[model samples]
Target: MTTNVLMTVPTGPGVGLTSVSVGLVRALEQQGLKASFFKPIAQPHPGDEGPDRSTAMVAQGSSLRPVEPIPLHEAERYLYNDNIDELMEEVVGRFQASVDNDSTIIVEGLAQIPGHPYATRLNKAIARTLDAGLVLVTAPNDMRVQDLEHHVEIAAGSYGGIKAHDVIGCILNKTIPGSLGAKSYGDQFARRPIFKRNFALLGQIPVAEELTYPRVKDVAEFLRARIINAGEMDTRRIQSYTLCARGVENVLEALRPGVLVFTPGDRTDVIMATAIAALNDIKIAALVLTGGYEPSAALIALCGKAMAKGLPILSVESNSWDTAIKMQSFNQEIPLDDKERILNVKEHIARCIDHDWINSFALNHEERKLSPPAFRYRLIEQARALNKRIVLPEGEEVRTIQAASICAERGIARCTLLGKEEEIRRIAQNNGIELNHGVEILDPDSIRERYVAPMVEIRKHKGLTDIVARELLQDQVVLGTMMLEQNHVDGLVSGAVHTTANTIRPALQLIKTSPDSSLVSSVFFMCLPDQVLVYGDCAINPDPSAEQLAEIAIQSADSARAFGIAPRVAMISYSTGGSGSGNDVEKVREATRIAQSRRPDLLIDGPLQYDAAIMEKVAQQKAPNSKVAGKATVFIFPDLNTGNTTYKAVQRSADVISIGPMLQGIRKPVNDLSRGALVDDIVYTIAITAIQAGSIGA
Candidate 1:
């Protein structure tokens, strides 16, 4: 199995899919596997309100914070429009929003529910799209032992058979414990022929009725009980209940932990007995008084100490028997606040999971594909860890301000906004965004004069004067770049409402190029549907010498490697190697030679056409022996016009998300955003700058 992505699918009815998912995650963690959780789309329950239960439940106990599931309304709308691909892309995007590269992601599949006829088809599509191995979760329910093989076969048949779906195994949940007969689940499905040869018996979780019991608060909400003493209601759990029709001495034995007792409010002897149990540290869930009777004030004073100790006492409008009848159909769904119970359920479920199978299952998880989500997830994590400070020049722009707030909140970086504080806040308020505290408001008018002297000092050789410097520092990008140049900030992001030249020219003048680089260039991390490709010199260096192009290629390749993409640099041209004669083709061919001689340690090949560079079949026919052909992660365009046009075309026509114009060879990190960039685009740009400013993989 390709174990990087595991999809947990329910075989049929009566399966505790969320419970199984929670248990599988815990078991993987216990074996020291770095695992993450994701539920792609929400399955909104009928007549219910709030988030998906599976998502809330899984996320409550997860070490990795999973993204909220895509809303059912939005998903159904996409489906109604026949935009299945768009829906799937959104799923991938949301999953990647929280998924990481260092962990195996266990995706819980959509349950086949009423009114949702596309559940199974969507499940199969998601599994196949993610290249995930499927683990079918089933329960004994009413299936006899003899029916085990038949059940497995039928369930496997639903998704094009076991072999076709890449079925890893089956997990039998909620098995009746201590059944010794072969006809029972004592053998845990091992006796079945499919288990013996074709399929794996992953685990058999016994019926732990405790996991299905509701807490005191859940009972209160369900029964609409009025609280007389709202004590430890959240923590107290209800496993069983007894009616106080007998004497107090007989009822005393039922006053144990996790038991709910019913009695008349005037039954002073029973109330006193429950209070005594609470004083002895016995945590009965709650004492429910029926028939609207209230204990005398003197009796309440007697039980005052127990009530103070968090003993919950509730009152109902109905008789004891009627209250019992009302609770007959009590929903046993796990409450999000019941942490202890959830943990216990997880532990029990994990204990029953086959530990050996888990380790062996994901043994080769590292071989999984480096997807766009994984790549972006890694970049953000690295930037967050470094915690470098990045400044935004266009901080008053709505998207820029929103991005800054997000960066600060996520710990991606300390964002300093170089604009008027009140103006920035106004923009935030107008957009209904709460500006995060980590975003520092630096009014450029107040700070511009401070940078004048330093900016002139750096550019005095170029005949820069104080007057010119003051005027230059008026541009916020210049001010922001000067802050970076003077080590006041680690990086700068700009160009939301400014031209690219306005953003980069200041950096070129003040910060200058790095010592090792001859000139500056740019690249965008093009997030293609399948993989991340680096398109270089796309935003900088309009025209270049063969040597300058070579330098750009080498620099772009290093940038790719620095950001965790294995750099297979492909110098793009209109012609294949030695196949055409032109100024462009010759320049690319000579540039490839220069780059190859300079960096023999790198995978640098070029004079390859775009098709030859990106398509494996074309590479086989045209440039068969080139190492950087067909599988290149870094594409070095010969000139800015071609690079810019190609990146934009691919980004728009194919609906790809690109992270860049990340500037290369700058002394400090200073990146430029597209004038039309979105809030997410700006946020990722900030992250890229922060990452560039620090030592990654340290």
Candidate 2:
């Protein structure tokens, strides 16, 4: 049977109006209801001049056509020119046009109140004309609960007057408990003997992280920008809903097995209410706070203790009401049309789609900081795009010089090479590599005098005199990096003749880490013919601690994502889960814990044997509930022994094309190549280094 529901986003920042609208649609659809949504009023263009991505997400599963954008003035026209009766007629007309009579129609109104010229009053009034029931969304904060009085007043105005049987109900969103601003208000509203019987809360929609942020495609389509934070986004995992308790009934009803966000600032009543909600072990991620509202010193201490023990806490500026609404709106991230059917569709899509592909799409569109894949054409185009100074450590190669010459001719970075000018010229001429005009050629023997003094000064604390430092700085690669560090060049590409260590050591000791990270590590692309895997710690750390392993997982996951791979981290150990347990298992488990603690946003599983980490059937027989086990793209080795042996064994036995032991966690992408590395290895190293430079600022 058709079930027509009118949904209104409650007033508050981060309120889940859009999200609830979407989720409700999904829930309804799952319950065998044919659902459709009506956004009679919607913001025209948020950023880009494209169709709203929200509408697209909601309609993703539908056989129906996409929602047509409603002009900003359409609401005004219907209310003013068309008249009230005619406005309802049009609403019904559009509803009928959008869905078959057997399908349920959900009318989504604007968020603002009437008389506030910009409020979605027009949509509400139209809903009234259609004789639809109303669902009011509110944050479960005391203040938000209190605000419901005014919202109810406003909602009543849409219907000409408040009615006893209007079917108006409340949906509280983003409920981190103990922040009772909404609870106080909602309680007071219910206690008022006159208006007491008018309102009933239908459901309390808890907060879910995936629902909070827009999807990568949606963000990309909205911003019209590329993603630079590729790795970070890949590491982000979606968690279940966390709710705030606005009332005892709301608390009892809202408390499901999902995560719940609770504030330390709640009264005993609210705390007890939430205590009951915590019976389920769906994984409590954190407790969030609004407006930097720190709980009392005692509660803060309590939470701090939890955090110390690896529990989490998330804080945002919007109050409880806003948090609730925003939590519900997480459904918007999926671009669903009907609010009721949004949740189911998104969950299905989340399960069905390859997260890595979604991550890759997001990498291209979001943050715009991560480097794109090393497409040969894009690499050449990038070199031709900027005018920064470029340095080639091994400037003697004919191919290297040829590439440099092409760059110079294109007005890209100025090319500088370390070689004897006469020798370079002879090789260029003999190999048909053009010596582009204005390219600077420096000989190690001749340039020592110019750079030795500066190198000595830069490393003055090393107790080296100018002469001694000059001898140490004799290596041309070292001199080249010094030049880049001294701002003489904007970028560098080398490692053709050099070992990975030989190429990177100079940069590491001299250039230093970026402001954001503390240590450097290595990551290899591990590109199998069919898919790419990211392996770490085969280069830098001989044997890392739990903390270091965690860092490696986070960083490698990021690296995998940068190259368009989904990063499900398998923290590999000798034992699978607790099987064959020992310090080794403890180390892997500890590392996994630290990684999750540090990121708290990544999908990481540890204490897993290599087989369990990679093979789905094996994982199913082992840690059946683990999400990252079989799908892991990033593998964290418990120690250097296992990590090295596993990678080499896989490389030899499977005949897979392994790209790294790519060094990461470093300030720059200074890659290490194995002894007797091929020309293809050198090319890939250059591509990686170039990609790093392109994505450096991020």
Candidate 3:
């Protein structure tokens, strides 16, 4: 009976959960449909007092009902016995009343639907309860393919060996536009009949500024309007057009072909010249009439005739060009396959959303094609195929041990722990965390044999000796990385209880660069439910020279492509297109130029304010010809100070979730994790590591 479009996103570890969710909400809302979002399980930090922080913000930004967030703990109380039905009943009861009288409701799931004790049951229950259609949002990186296939297997299997209806379709998030290899992944899913039958491709949302970071240009494009009482003009023509007041004949004379005429609609002199230019085949394409009034009847008739001959007219009601520009610069560009189909999107929600869809998905099915058990096994098999050795550096911790045990129990990896063997065993036993059978326990002392040789090799290159290698190898982080490079392990993870420098230095000294890379860069896959937003050089290279920034942009864009994100890059700065002048602007401009020259294959804009990069209105005002403005996915910051502060500010202030500072341009496996990383961090690092290993061959 609820008019809300009940939507759910099923997630797993290393997936871009929030990114997909954010993009989906944006896309749905662009159609004027009211939509709401909910997070079933919000991981609470040690001293947090708020609701699921990410979910809370999503709900706030969404077009759905604006309900106060229920604290995670309070929500848990209603999950009595962790029953799926109980939780759904409570959520619906609590949220139903607060939602708009008519709006769509979206539910965001935690990573790995089955990883949590009650996840499997909760997913199905909510699906059935809301009668919502399931949209399985997956990250499109190399590791993501395995994850997708794994999800497919689980859907075919049981929620817990019990059968139920599974997800209906998939939205391939952060997909690169021209990456044929990535695009071919659709065929891989098609090979599986169950997934093929259930999987509908809603669309692949690429990495772009419009979705990743709010850019001013995107806003400009969105708010722009055609000064009307005239005929049809070309959108492309208006793209590069500059607006000048009617009396400013000097400015008009100085203008080029893409200039917009701004005047009262009754200004016959301006209209006649513009029309004559078009008739004479002048390149002039657009005009902006101010004063909030239409042209005289005679002028309208003439304009109507011109429109019949193909000169488009746009009407604006603002009195001044500045006012018109300001008013027209507040909207965003909403891209759908067909803008006209937005109505259908709303109707689809109205007709298809119902109780049957929700109930069917909620029941636990053992025979479901993509059962959790199958997904786990599939990842394990994929790991084997890659010959990747999964290392649990924080194995002494309870969470790490549990994760280790799970991986080992599933035969997904050859697991290793960082602490002493005895200490690991004691901690696992005391904490009731099972250390799976044959899980390898390695102490810093034991890894010496495996790492010493690689350390020696690195030292030898530096004109040092075996003695120095032994001393550095004594450092666990260094030794761990050395172990990986030496083939003692295929990957490594350390950062929890260690500094970024400590975690990364070892790899930097040993693993070095990829064959073609000159310098290393860092990026984060800000995974939303329907998209993966990539941010680059936000971690390393604090004040890179223009050349370095360009390299960073190129590297980030490539990394995005590898992850199936279409790389529309925005070189963000305080100034936009020389609008505001400064050394910083110059740096960004140079970086943009270099990046365009370097890649040539990518869409990029520089000296753009954040809003201009992603917002339509801003895009129109500045950098009109820019393909990247208002649609960039890869945001290359001017400097580390700005990049770090901006990313953090967006995370803290805007309530946006950031996923990485993923190390790039490295020759082999070398990644840094946040000091306050959770289990999910380790999982993503492993995923990135796996992808890095594979990228060598690629």
Per-residue lDDT for 1-698 in model 2, tens only? 11255556455444656656655554444332345677665554333345554466566543335365465566567667757566566666766666555445566666654344646456556655666666666564434544656755565555443453554555556654354533444445555432555555544444444345333233223323233113212212224444564655565544432234544234444444443333222223334444445446665444343344333344455566666565553334433333323533354222222222223212123222111122222334454554455677788875566656655654554678889888888666533356667477877787667777777776777776987767767777788777766766666666667776777778787777766666787765564523457777666777887877888888888777665566789888878776777776887789988888887777888888878887889989998999988777788876667677777888788765566556566565455555445444544454455556656644
How do the residues 594-665 of candidate 3 rate in per-residue lDDT, one tens digit apiece? Answer: 989987888888888899887777798887888888877788888788888877877677555465677888
Judge candidate 1 against the unseen true structure and give its global Cα lDDT, from 0 to 1: 0.82
lDDT of every predicted structure (CA atoms): 0.82, 0.57, 0.59
In the range 366-456, model 1's lDDT, one tens digit per residue, is 5343456456656777899999999898877878887888888778999998778877776575344578689899988887888888888
For candidate 2, the lDDT comes to 0.57
TM-score of 3: 0.50
Of candidate 3, the 10-residue stretch with the lowest lDDT total is: 367-376
What are the runs in model 1 whose C-alpha is more than 4 Å off? 1-369, 696-698
Question: What's the residue-level lDDT of 426 in candidate 1?
Answer: 63
Q: In candidate 3, how many Å is residue 68 off? A: 12
* Top-TM-score structure, candidate number: 1
Global Cα lDDT for candidate 3: 0.59
